[model samples]
Target: MLELHLNFCNLVEIPDAIGNLHFLEILNLMGNNFSTLPSLKELSKLQLLNLKDCRQLKYLPNLPSRTDLSSKRSLPESFSSKKDPWAFERFYDYMEAGLNTFGCPELIELERCTSTALSWTLQILLQVHYQYILPSLWNIPFPSIISSIIGGSEIPSWFNNHREGMGSIITIDESPLMHKGNNCIALACCVVFGPPASRRKAPPIIHSLNHVSVPFLCAEDRITEDHLWWFYVTSGSHIWSTKYENLKLQFHIIRESDIESWSFHGKKYGYRWVYEKDLEESNLTMICSR
Candidate 1:
């Protein structure tokens, strides 16, 4: 077959029998929860495979042999200079085409710096480059200036040889940030620095509507009533209150359209009567760019 479209269906996995179609050139498996795919070693003619929006997919298996080292016709000439014949540009083009053809939502472009960092992280994880960077974090001495900024206690010596330290350094097993009965809690710490003169300066000011209990959900998990929510006014400055002492807060300005009303200590803050017009105007500009 020249093309096969399987979109918006609740498929949990691909059937191994698909490999029987040796002439199959394109297969779209979008909008599914498939965590794994069947081997396609027999489909020598396969040219494209789409797995867009397969959020649960954590790992991809090795490509089949016919498409591997022994292939007579190689990847495009543009990708020949790279160590791996299958260069990233080609993969990204294929991915984008697949997503568009398979009815995936349009990609949103964020701020340049934020998008660049996110793309780098995704590329590193996908290419398995964790082996090179993870260990170096452990080589840095504990109680160092960098560690203290991100609230890390100390660096371990074992990480000097291995680079896959993502799991080791971000352990939340005994962390106070984890809530009881919520085994899904995870913690990630990173140190972000601005100019040298502003190294110790506080972060931006963020004002929350009220003290509300909010649930923090993991990206992999589904939204549920079990989630809790907590709200507080936070900024980068060091502040002490008898109620919330020595808290380090970072502020984020979400759109006012997303918020319902302001609440402080379980009482309504009456923000609607005061800041509604200005908040709405700001929301319009901020939401569109993001």
Candidate 2:
């Protein structure tokens, strides 16, 4: 089993044998009855452990910290190209829609995010692995999920620039971050979106045509949350550079048939998705937290 949610079970203690579920990745013990958590060092594959509102919880073990691709699950064989939710066509539509979502994107997007994140992490993890080259022998693949969970509504600490409102141009100097950035190995984007929309308007975006995220989205609730995207981009030179290109993030461009001809960001292609009934068209703004 990969997940175990024992939230609000009113238990006083947990058995140490749980640590033996080596394949476990997520263990949520919120509102459980316990002051201390048992030693969880054996859960080598664990990725997330939620302990929210565990009022009695007073201590935790030296939890496993390895965050790599060891737990990456391949797409299942049950997947069908036409009948399934994560069909290729749905993915293409989402891509053509600029890859934006109502709030939290469907987990299928996780694959895209993971690929890009790997690029950004490769530059750093490669250096770490190099130090132990003899022991590692590079038998493992390096995947990263940098958890930027923070308190309140502030930009994540990793971003380089940020601003409010839409249609704003946050310019990037050709050789930006000359002294600070890590040679611009990759670009990560975060967008806060969504407002409650009725089923008529929300179904398309919420139950996104791609259907890959169907398992992730709760159809009954509103998707008012932040969405993040990462891209493995190459700097003009040296793979990644201190100086970067103009990273223009244009959000909420109400495009029409003629909008693409003059819009450089539109990439010379006509956008056809605008005709749909926009029941709750969101106001999108890009705060470049590079």
RMSD of each: 21.2, 14.9
How do the predictions measure up, each by TM-score?
A: 0.26, 0.38
lDDT of 1 by residue, 1-290 (tens): 64566856988887888777666645667678776667665765444455545556544432333321111222243444246643543333322211111112222221321222222222222222112122233431111110011101122221122122221011212322222123321111221211122112222234521121111111212211111011111111022121332123232211112222221111101011111231233433342234
Residue 39's lDDT within candidate 2 is 72
- Name the regions of candidate 1 deviating beyond 4 angstroms: 68-290
lDDT value, candidate 2, whole model: 0.35
- Write down the TM-score for model 1: 0.26
lDDT of each: 0.29, 0.35
lDDT tens per residue, model 2, 42-107: 776554555544555544444543322244433233435546644542222211111122232222
What are the per-model numbers of colliding residue pairs? 10, 7
